[model samples]
Target chain A: MLKVRVIPTLLWKNFGLVKGVGFDSWRRVGPVLPTIKVYNSREVDELILVDITASIEGHIPDHESVSDFSHECFVPLTVGGGIFNLSQITSLLRAGADKVSLNSALFENPGLVNDAAGQFGVQCVIVSIDAHRTERGSYTCFSHSGTRNTNREPLAWAKEMEDRGAGEILLTSVEHDGTMNGYDLELIERVASRVNIPVIASGGAGNYQDMIDAVTKAGAAAVAAASIFHFTEMTPLGAKDAMHEAGIPIRRRFEM
Target chain B: MKVALINYGMGNLGSVRRALEDLGANVIIAEHPLMLLDANRLVLPGVGSFGAGMERLRNGGWIEALYQQVIEHHKPILGICLGMQMLSGLSEENGLHEGLNFIPGKVLRLDKLGCSLRIPHVGWNEVNYREGMGLFNKIPQAMDFYFVHSYAVVVEDPADVSATTSYGTTVTSAISRHNIFGTQFHPEKSSKSGKQILKNFLDYTPC
Candidate 1:
C-alpha cells in the first residue's frame, strides 16, 4: 500500500528557520541544519526546505546549504524557492535534492515546467500553488511567496500544471497558512479531485486531526505542516500514531 | 570493497555515494568507462527519460564498457530507478526506445497497468520479496522503501523477479538475473531498510 506522507516543511530565510502568518511577519525559529537533524531523528517521512526569500531576492536556491543539509539527512529532501530554470533544478539535484518545487518561476514561464520535466523526469518536477479564498468564495492563486495574486483560478491552474508535466501539486492555502486553525478542506478537495497527480496539502494544520482531515476528507495524498512540528511539542510520531489509529495507511519505523 | 557509482549525467549520485560510504564501502563516481575496471562492484544510478539516458550512455561510450564488465567479467551491477528501467528490453517513455537488455523485460507506465492509481506513484510502499534472493537477506518482510517513478519493469521471465509491490496492481519492484540486479525504488533514501539493502548488496558475492 502507498502510505500517506507526513512531511515537515521548514521555511528558511537569511540562513535561519522562520515561520510567517498569512505569508508575512516572519519570526525566527532557529538554525536550519539542527531543525533538520531533529526531524531526521524523529523519522519524518520527508522534508521540504523552502527558501522563503529566494524569489523576492532574485536568486536561485542556495545549493550549498541544500548539499550540506542533505549530506547529514537520510530521508528524501525536496528544495523549493527561486528555482527558475532547468539548470537550477540540475544544481539542486546534484546537491542531493530528490525533487525541486517551482512557484513564481512556474507562473512566469509555464513552459519551464515542461522543459524541466523533459530534461529531468516529471517525477522530479513539483508545482506549488499558494491559494487564498476570495470575497466571492472562489479561490485565486498567488505567486512570489504569496505577495502577488494571479488572475487564474486554483482548480484550473492545478489541472493546467498537471498537463504541463508537473508530477505533483503542492496546494497551500494562503489564508490558512500560519493560522494553525485547520486546513482549507474545501480548497484541498477542489484541487485534489480535479488533478490526476498526487496533491500535497499545506498550511492550516493545528493538530493531528487537521492532518487526518486533510487526507481523509480533502483527498490529499500527503499532509505537511511547519507550525505544529516547529512550535509545539507534538512530534511526527504522535501525528503518525493518530493517523494510524484513524486507519490511514502510513509507514512506521521498523523496531529492532 | 570498492564500488564504482556510474554517473551518466543524471540522478542523485551524492545520496547514493553517501549511503554506500556509510556502509564502509569505498565509493567512486565513475565518470569515464575506464573507472569501472578498478572497482569490485558497479552501481548505475540515473534520473531522467529513458531515451536521453540511453543516448548519453551510447554517446559517452559506456555501453561497451558496461557489457564487458557486467557480462564478460561478471561484475555485480545494481541499477536504481531510471537505471533499473534502462535494464529492460525497451521503454515507451518519450517514444519507444531500446534498453540495455541485460534483463528480458519492458518498461511500461504505471497508468497503463490498467489501475486508477495516481501517476508517478510517489511515497513509500511495502515490498514483498521472494525467498533465496540475496538482497533481502536481513531486511524485514514487507518493509517500506521510498519510490518515485511512473514506469515499472515487466520481466519476461518470472524467475528474474526477486520482489513485488502493489499500487493499483501488482508491480515488479526488483529483478535479479545472475550478476545483474535492479530496484525501481531509491534505496539510498529509504532510511534503515534502504541502508540494510545496500549493505546486503555490498555483501553479495555473485556466482
Candidate 2:
C-alpha cells in the first residue's frame, strides 16, 4: 500500500525561511539550511521549498540553495517559485531538485507545462494552485504567491493542468493558508475527486487531526504544512505517529 | 569497491551518487560506456519516458557496451526506476519501445491493470521480498521504499521476481536473475530503508 506523504513545506524569501498568516505579514523563522537539516533528521517524507519572491521579482530560483539542500538532505527535494522557462527547469533539475513547481508562468505560458513535461517527463512537473475562496463560495485560483488573482476556477484550472501534462497538483487554500486552523477539506475533496492525479493539500494544518481529515475526507494523496511544522514544537514523526493512530497509512522511520 | 553510476540524462543522479558515497563505495558518474570498464558494479539510474531513455542509451553509445559488461563480463548491474523498466524486453509507454531485454518482461501502464488506484503510484510503499535475495539482504520484508512511476514491469517468469508491491494490484517491484537486478522504486531517495538496499547492492557478489 502507498503511504500518505507527510511533507514539510518551507517558504523561501531572499534566502531565508519565513512563515506568514494567509500569505501576509511574513515572519522569518530561521535560516533555510538549518530548518532543512532538522527536517532531514526527522525523516520527512518529502520537502517542498518555494521562493515567495521569485515570480514577483522576476528572478529565478536559487539553484545554489537547491543544490545545497539536495546535498545535505537525502530525501526528495521539490523547488518552486519563479520557474518560468525550460532552461530554468533544466538548471534546477541539474542542480539536484527532484521536481519543479510552477504557478504564474503556467498561466502566462501554459505551453511551458507541456514543454517541461515533455523534456523532463510529467512526473517531475507539478502545477501549484493557490486558490482563494470567492464571495460565491467557489474557489478562485491565485498566482504570484497569492498576490494576484487569476480569476480562474480552481476546478477547471486543475483539470486543464492535468491535461497539459501535470503529474500532480499542489492545492493551497489562500483563505486557510497560515491560519493553522486546518486544510480546506471541501476544496480538496472537490478538486481531488475530479482529477485522477495525486493532490497535495497545503496550508492550514493546526494539528495532526487536520492532516488526517485532509486524507480521509478530502481524498488527498499527501498533506503539506508550513506553519504547524515550522512554528510549533511538533515534528514530522510526531505528526506521523498521530496519523498512524488515526489509521492513516504512513511510512514509519526505521529504528537505527 | 568501485561503482559506475550511469548518467544517461534522466533521473536525479546526485542523490543516488551521494547515497553510494555515504555507503563508502567509490562512485563515479560514467558518462561514457568506456568509463564503466574499470568498475566492478554498475548502477543505471533514470527518470523519464521509455522511448526517450532507450533513445539516449542508443545515441550515447551505451547499449552495446552495457550488454558486453553485463553478459560477457558478468558485472553486477542494478537499474533504478525507468532504468529498471529499460532492463525489460519492451514497454507499452508512448507506444511500443524496445528495452535492454536483460530481464524477461514487458512494461505496462498501471492504470490498464483495471485498478482504481492513481496513476504514477507516487510516494513510499512497502516492498515484500523473498528471503536470501542478494539486493534485499538485511532489509526487512515489506520495508517501505519511495516509488514514482506510471508503469511497472510484468515479468515473464515468476522466479525472476524478487519483490512485489501493491498499489491497485500486485505489481513487480524488484527483480533479480543471476547478475541482473532492477528495482521499480528509487532506493536512493527512500531514506534509511533505501540506504540499506543500496548497501546490499554494494555487498552483492555476482555469482
Per-prediction DockQ comes to 0.55, 0.59
- Least lDDT summed over 10 consecutive residues: which range in candidate 1 chain B? B113-122
- Give the lDDT of residue A103 in candidate 1: 89
Model 1 lDDT per residue over A1-256, tens place: 8899899999999879999889999999999989987887787888999999999998977888899888767789989999888889988988988888998987779999999888776878889999989999999999999999887899999999999999889999999999999999999999999998889999999999999999999999999999988789888989999999999999867632
Model 2 per-residue lDDT tens digits across residues A1-256: 8788899999999968999998899999999888887887788999999999999999878788788788766678899999999999999998999899999998889999999988777878899999999888888989999999988999999999999999889999998999999999999999999898889999899999999999999999999999998778887899899999999989977743
lDDT tens digits, residue span B39-60, model 2: 9999999888899999999999
Q: Could you tell me how far off, in angstroms, the CA of residue A105 lies in candidate 2 after the best superposition? A: 2.1
* Candidate 2 residue pairs in backbone clash: none
Error of 1 at A68 (Å): 2.7
Isolated chain B TM-score per model = 0.98, 0.98
Q: Which 10-residue span in candidate 2 chain A carries the lowest summed lDDT?
A: A247-256
Error of 2 at A192 (Å): 3.0
